[model samples]
Target: MLKNFNWKDESGFTLVEMLIVLLVVSVLLLLTIPNIVKQSKSINDKGCDAFITMVQGQAQAYQLENNKVPSLQDLLAGGYLKGEQKKCPNGKDVQIDSSGKVTEVR
Candidate 1:
């Protein structure tokens, strides 16, 4: 009778294969991180624009009805906006001073 050998062999990934996988994963992460950052910036910028538009629209409406410049308190009291206080709604505030220039108070 022929002798039979049946032993289980352990398997594991080689060092080069492991290193290749690690390098590939790192490269993919590097590629994806920038895109994620850009997308996040885009979202913030869009939100800021929308908030500015809402504020300006309400201010214009108040001015039209009153036939004069509208104050922040006036807008808050007139129910043109939901909040009792005026805020840019994106971690900012609408800045309108004695001059006509408006900026987002970040």
Candidate 2:
């Protein structure tokens, strides 16, 4: 029976090959996951910066129209900014100073 079996006709991957493939995939994931996390933080920071700029522009517009510096509440109450716009995308609250300058809470 052993003499009649053919050893050269195997059509599937061996255990070693499968384990190598899995190791490669795991290494790729390890390399990419940290990059993804770093990018997410960067994106959030940029988004918050953009939000601050927009709010600053709106504050300037409000000042031009009203002839006075507007607070954060004033912008919200006057409909220049929506309620949700009071905060940055990163969950930081925005504030408008007496000079109509917009800034993050911290």
The per-model lDDT (C-alpha) reads 0.73, 0.88
Which stretches of candidate 1 lie above 4 Å from their native place? 1-23, 84-90, 98-102
Residue-level lDDT of model 1, residues 27-82, one tens digit each, is 99999999998898788778888877777777788778888676677777888767
- Model 2 lDDT tens row, 25-90: 999999999999999988988999999999899898999999999988888899988865788777
RMSD of each: 5.2, 4.3
Candidate 2's C-alpha runs over 4 A off are 1-10
Worst 10 residues of 2 by lDDT: 1-10
TM-score on alpha carbons, each prediction: 0.58, 0.78
Name the TM-score of candidate 1: 0.58
Note the residue pairs that clash in candidate 2.
none
